[model samples]
Target: MNKPDVSYSIFQDWRANRGNIKAQFILSLFRLATWVRSNKILIILFIWYLPFYRFFVEWVMGIELPWSLKAGRGLKLQHGQALVVHGQTIIGSNCGLKHSTTIGIRMNPDGSVGRAPIIGNNVDIGAHVCIIGAIEIGDNVAIGAGSIVVKSIPPNCVVVGNPARVVKVNEPVTSSYS
Candidate 1:
């Protein structure tokens, strides 16, 4: 199934944190715009989402997304469509959530639900990554394309493949950084 688009509170949460730099926010906004512009197909689908995102929040889901959702300074969503963020998910600053990423919890044995994910800052989640359960992803971790992340990942690691093995380390993105 396609991931749903992000709602207005995503940006609102980022903006509310005054400690987050303005330059980083501008850069993130720029990144989002440029990435969407380059991908016309994604833009078309997301265009429709903007209205719903701007108009509806209460009528959509029951979970109340806490302020910031633990999302830090610069949150960049590249073609984020059909993405589901459960209330338990905790993200960090300068994170990248690509298209179709679902950040939620797993089903219990009795068909209830487990704990939410605790993601660190400066992380990059690739498209179609399903991160479930009570995993604590470290800072600057990059989840690879089409990965299913169930376990906790250490900081600065690049995770890939089914169940996602650490393929590389996240060397800080120094250049062109705000």
Candidate 2:
């Protein structure tokens, strides 16, 4: 797998969540919180500020995106409510997430915690979607709403329904997002 970009610019991500006040506020707050955690001197300040951050991001915004999450650039969160992404999940660049989506891990039968999904670039996921387990979502994929994705998906496909069977494959990649 290719290495993820180490450089993180809040402005670039802000541009993606632009025109949406909720998305802008939530993402900016997350970025700032992460930045503070990354700095040794600022971590001291974060110790006192962590509670407020959790309250606002979890209770107010209704988003459970951890500051430690490795999300890529241009992550557009549409109707950013009830969205929960696991900290271990790696989301690629130019991905769109709608409301009521859960991208997390599935528990093992032995009652152990499992790994989260690694989503690829330019993937658009709709509302009421649950993408669970240690699956890999390929780039340029579009997932319909109310879908439950468990298995790994290939690149450039359109998947939907309860089990998320691939309905279309090798679809053309779109450049712009609305």
Alpha-carbon lDDT, every model: 0.64, 0.87
**For model 1, what is the C-alpha lDDT against the true structure?**
0.64
**Candidate topping TM-score:** 2
Every model's TM-score: 0.60, 0.89
Expressed as tens digits, the lDDT of each residue in 1-178 for candidate 1 is 0122233433543554345453234334433443344456867966764344323432342212332244444566565445667755777766777767788888989998898999888788999888989889998888988999999999978899898889887576567856
Task: List all candidate RMSDs to the true structure.
Answer: 12.2, 4.4
Question: Clash pairs of candidate 2?
Answer: none
Residue 154 local lDDT, model 1: 91
Residue by residue across 35-149, what tens digits does model 2's lDDT show?
A: 6667677778668666778899999889998977888878889999999999899999999999999999999999999999999999999999999999999999999999999
Displacement of the residue 44 alpha carbon in candidate 2, Å: 1.0
